[model samples]
Target: MQIDPRGPRFAAVLTSAVLAASLITDSGVLLAVQALVFALGAAGRSPYSLLFRAVVRPRLAPPAELEDARPPRFAQCVGLAFALFGLLGHLTGTAWLALAATGLALAAAFLNAAFDYCLGCEFYLLLHRARPRPGT
Candidate 1:
């Protein structure tokens, strides 16, 4: 089975570390960092694109045309929102909720890696197709 090249491996790493640390202590800082990572990716930071390019090309070998849809803008938004929800759960001391959200995100990434269907990305493309473009 082909895996998705753009799986959230890095984000998963960061989330894992943050979740570990969040367990032993109370630190808004860790949650903030997690949210920031998602925000950066959502904002189209170059590093995110570089990471995507690096992973997708040699590792997954998705068609070159996928670059035009790099990160799938709407998927990035969903990711950012999910991360933010996790952060909010942390701030509010909702441990189970926070963990559930984080776990869901991680599981989704793993599924994408294994099965090549990015659920969030599909939503992104749907949104992209439903909207009217500029000057159209």
Candidate 2:
């Protein structure tokens, strides 16, 4: 599926805010909620994207380009993985691990939100390039 290029960036802004809040509050519950968001995003049913379509997109002009959904979905999976690790730390009472993982996720989200850089998307591209071609 194709998506407005801005959609993922919009989601990233929200994700960054949510992640920052979770870090400041040290709230496992909040992190869990973000994790759910990540899970939904990975499944291509992100609530944030729905919100963007229903609410935010209506206010904006048309996008100059669209993008493949696969990369962002892969990025969501990467986010989910980190979120799960953070939750695991919370469950196991490993404060450092929880903070570290959450912090890393926050950094990634912030990069996407503020700079339009997506590390996970880059990783996805890297992996896609490394895969063997049918003719190879």
Candidate 3:
């Protein structure tokens, strides 16, 4: 499925806010909640996405082009991985680890939201390029 290019960026902005809160408060619960949101997004079942579709998308002109959904979905999975690591760090009493994980996630989210850059999507492309070709 294809999606409006703005959809993922909108979700990124939301993710960045929650992540910022988690870092600022040093709250494990907030981190975990953010992780759940990322997981839902990765699975293409996010409430945020739904809200954006129903309420936000209609307000703007349609996108100039639709993008394949896989890139954004892959980005979400990377985001979920980071959130999981942050959760683990919090649960294990490793402050540095948790901060690092959440910090990385926040940076990525900020980049996506502010610049429309998707590190996870770029990683996905790199991984595909690294794969051995079939019928070689």
Candidate 4:
């Protein structure tokens, strides 16, 4: 499926806010909520993206280009992994680990939101390129 490239960036903005709040308040529950969002996104049903479509997109002009959904879905999976790691740290009483993992997630979200640079998407592309092909 193709998606408006802006949708993921919008989601990233919201994600950055949520992750930052989770880190600042040290709220495991909040982080868990974000994890759920990541899970949903990975499954191709991102709430943030839905919100963007319903609420935000209507107000703006149409996107210049659409993107394949797979990369963003993979990016969501990566976010889910980091969020789970952070949640584990919270559960295990490892403050540094929790903060570090959450911080890393926030950094990536911020990058996407601010710079349109999705590290996870780039990684997905890299891995996609590296996979063996049938005729290689």
lDDT string for model 1 (17-38, tens) is: 6645654465556656656766
Decoy 4 TM-score against native: 0.98
Give each model's whole-structure lDDT. Answer: 0.58, 0.97, 0.92, 0.97
Measured against the true structure, the TM-scores of the candidates, in listed sequence, are 0.61, 0.98, 0.97, 0.98
Clashing pairs in 2: none
Q: Write the per-residue lDDT of candidate 4 for residues 71-94, one digit (tens) a residue.
A: 999999999999999999999999
Ten-residue region with minimum lDDT total, candidate 1:
1-10
- The C-alpha RMSD of each candidate to the native structure, in angstroms, is 5.5, 0.6, 0.8, 0.6
Candidate 2 lDDT tens digits, 23-102: 99999999999999999999999999999999999999999989999999999999999999999999999999999999
Q: Rank the candidates by TM-score, best first.
A: 2, 4, 3, 1
Q: What C-alpha lDDT, on a 0 to 100 scale, does residue 130 get in candidate 1?
A: 91
lDDT (Cα) of model 3: 0.92
* Candidate 2 lDDT for residue 31: 100
